[model samples]
Target chain A: MSVVSAEALRERPVEAVPEDAHDDGLAPRAKFLPSLGAVYRAQLSRARVARIPLLFVATFQSIGIMILMRGVVDQGGREAQAVVAGSAVLVVAFVALNLLAQYFGQLRAAGGLDHYATLPVPPASVVLGAAGAYASFTVPGTVVTAVVGCAMFDLPLTHLWVLAAVIPLAGAALSGLGAALGLLAPRPELATLLGQLGMSAALLLGVLPADRMPEFVQYARDLLPSTYGVEAFARTFGDHPDWATVLLDLGVCAGVGVASLAVATWAYRRAAVR
Target chain B: MCAVRGLSKTYPAARGRRGAPGTPAVRATDDVRLDIRRGEIFGLLGPNGAGKSTLVRQLTGLMRPDSGSVEILGHDIVRYPERAARILAYLGQESTALDELTVSLAAETTGRLRGLSLKDARAERDDVLEELGLTALAARPLKKLSGGQRRLACFAAALVGRRPLLVLDEPTTGMDPVARRAVWAAVDRRRAERGATVLLVTHNVIEAETVLDRVAVLDQGRVIACDSPAGLKERVAGEVRVELVWREKAPMELSEVARLRERAVESGRRWSLRLAPDEARSAVAAVTGGPAFDFLDDFTLATPSLEDVYLALGGSRSGVKGLVKA
Candidate 1:
């Protein structure tokens, strides 16, 4: 063999050698098998380490709000349940709003897309990995929100498994949407504006009771995923278990998650190739 | 081994530009073709806006060519990028280091991603850190390092993969002469010990000449010349000239010595002669033959170098006009 070809053969791993050869016995496996889980874990670890301050603030805020709500519930005033439920919905929205905004903002500002594009992993893997990091970062807030919501408002712990599933699903859905928004936004300033608009829309649909709103407003609220989240959380606090409502909410959140994830995947691929 | 054939790239024109009543595409690469042999240090020399980085990006599978094919180690970059990526290591002109991560962690992570075991990764990291003189700042975050140090760290990350092919885009930029030499030494070692192929994109001709086995010069997205450094220098027409100066005035002028030798053999007094285009041997013989030649104080011989060829071929104003005409 010529020198160039010989050098090329020497660089190949033993597994890539032909079967007829009496060379080192090794078998070739599938090539370019991307380890999505490994990439996800790395991204999660990086984000977790970088967002320490945000985590601290979320923890303290959750505790303080829980304490304040407990005191309000002790007063036993008329319409206290209504006020407590409204406050719970507002708190959930606040936590979700801040977490999503911060996560997306950081992703854009850090040039995370550029970093992932040059990796050996596929573009889909990069998108999922970044989304997974945001998902992991929201876990602490999701847990704190559910735990505090139940304890402070004297809410029942029935159907705990379903509630446990709901929190992470909600967090993932919101985070996915946020990631898509971050990808689409031209700049940080635009992202902030769009984030505020999203938060405002969510608050209007989520914190206020549909029955209290006018007919047209209630009809509009049905289009939003946040309305389903509010219904699910409120039903958990009530005496009757609304299984159908819970299923519908989970289905809608899952659909939104899937759609946003698709957007993120497309955006990531475009960014990589460009 | 990497091969790029008939590659072309055009960037979209920006908005609000009036040209022929429509926006025109900026042709970044124009039907460029080259083959990088295994275990050889090939240099791509070009000035700014010469599309060297674009070509490098295409070979490394960072970008798809608008038209043409790029195969890395027998795998087509467009059709099988993942397979190509396993054996190819790319260090872009821009620093790709995560500012928050320590230098050691960046190298370790790069190794891990390339499928190195943790123990092996750590061992390799230490070896590379020591080799690049980065041991003292291994624990420091990338943000803390100077521009040159950060570039070195990025280079170390690229080397950590231990892939068979390395594509370096301006690798020695922001490096001191000692550090640059050290990098060249490491690159040479890789080619010698592991038979690694390296594609170096650089504009610094002097530094590149030390390591490149062959060079391709690109001008405005086209390959104008491709050959070994010595071969390229030989293409330029010139003769080696030697000038000899004595402490005192010589009895005969340099031209007189040449004409007198052609006419007849004559005894000579103390004389210093400057050899013409092709007369070094006879001139040296006649000078040494006389006793006065023993007092020769200093002599210097100058020949055409790569820099001179580069200037004649690319730097001259008329050369560019000629190329355009051709």
Candidate 2:
């Protein structure tokens, strides 16, 4: 609370912008965005080295659930397709949702944001870069789960390429949710608990057959961001797939991904300055 | 060069069972102003909770001030923080490097984040690592290193950028004596070779006294004094201090020490006394010239130092926090 002279507080006139003392021009204003590729590469390297084992676990856990469901669901049925698609998407949720929440939560709790805040890069680069890195980690695991689940259920192999788009879009939405939860939680332990609960909800509401659930429960399923992604992938399994409805569902997933990541970016800025 | 004018911040108190329901918010920083000149090492000296970290955060644009502004390299940092980043390199009080990264990678990444090209960042990282004797640990992950090693890596990252301004908070906190000396040598080289302005915030007054060109002593969120080490020490020049060690076989009786009792502060086997400039010479002479001199094993005359100035100005031995009265 050092007192400023009253004159300094008044806005300077436009004409006076270049008139005062100490105006050496050696230092220029920095660009709002640094190289996004540099940030992406660094974040990706960190994720690969620190979280790959967990990614493996996510893949096997999803496949394990599918195998457990094989005994209950009849082969070559829509319910079997739902199980395969939902479990595949669940791997994305495990990393993008459960693990990312813990990462940012621990980062904030340990005062790590101060380092990034002092750098010249834009806050969005950090948000998007870390989100992208964590999402990329899910690609191999998501693909493995999807391909294995399809074979286990005797589903056709022609539509498995849908996973490429499905993984990132679904990953963005879930990772954004995870990042927000981590950044907002007061403690790291609380962030971990919230992340696990969020992943558990995705597993129960997103994977099960919609026909088996009551109408109200289905409404709740529609609210989960990953459900649209699951529905989009599940539609591709039919002998005659509805391409229009598939694109629409995928479009919803993409839209939600953008909106959720935006909120997570805002949350990052809010938490960092505190 | 950097200047902070009229900086102030207030943090809202948490509302819960432990909160005093109607108490006012905590004022972490009160109207504070400071100037760090070009190519000079300026020290911000204070006990804990004196707003040192808060002031540095404002200067580095890590936090927004509720009022006032910081101008760096002739640009107002509050309005153009990115420009500040272009000129200023900061090492925060907390260790902020990514734990999963190797030391060299962390340094290079930090340099890149500050706008260096990959090639230049790598070269700078190599030179700094060799200079700090951290080359041996270049490939080690941060979490695997000892506490001192991690601190050295953080210091290396801050030093390699070669910006015009450097802001370091407790940069030598966990370092050993040799490492501490090495870090100071690096800082000296930066100022001497590059003419960089350094804003060093630390509680290690003794070590900083040897390198600081000027220092501001903060207490209870306000600056109590600002001057060169010599100038600050001169404030108490009228008095002299003497260290005494008494002979175990010939301890003097209290009656014989009556003449020096009032002005003395004693602890254990040593006694310190303050005397007017004219009286000091005679006092030292009397203590050593008298018959009771046989009771003293050793005594040495000394001038007041920056440590004395800090203690005298802070008014307390502990780094306790409270509001300073206007």
The number of the candidate with the highest DockQ is 2
Q: Which runs in model 1 stand beyond 4 Å of their true positions?
A: A1-34, A55-115, A144-163, A184-196, A208-230, A239-244, B17-24, B95-97, B116-127, B133-139, B176-182, B235-311, B315-326
Question: Least lDDT summed over 10 consecutive residues: which range in candidate 2 chain B?
Answer: B317-326
- TM-score versus the correct structure, for each prediction: 0.70, 0.84
RMSD of each: 10.7, 8.0
lDDT by residue (A83-115, candidate 1, tens digit) is 333333333334444445544555555454434
- Candidate 2 residues B263-284, lDDT tens each? 5555566666656656777766
Per-residue lDDT of candidate 2, residues A5-61 (tens digit): 335334422232222122463333223355455566777877776788898889988
B316: Cα error in model 2, Å: 2.9
The per-residue C-alpha lDDT of model 1 at residue B83 equals 52
Give the chain A TM-score for each candidate: 0.70, 0.88
Cα RMSD for predicted model 2: 8.0
lDDT computed for candidate 1:
0.63
Model 2 residue runs over 4 Å out of place are: A1-34, A186-190, B16-24, B240-302, B320-326
Model 1: which residue pairs collide? Answer: none
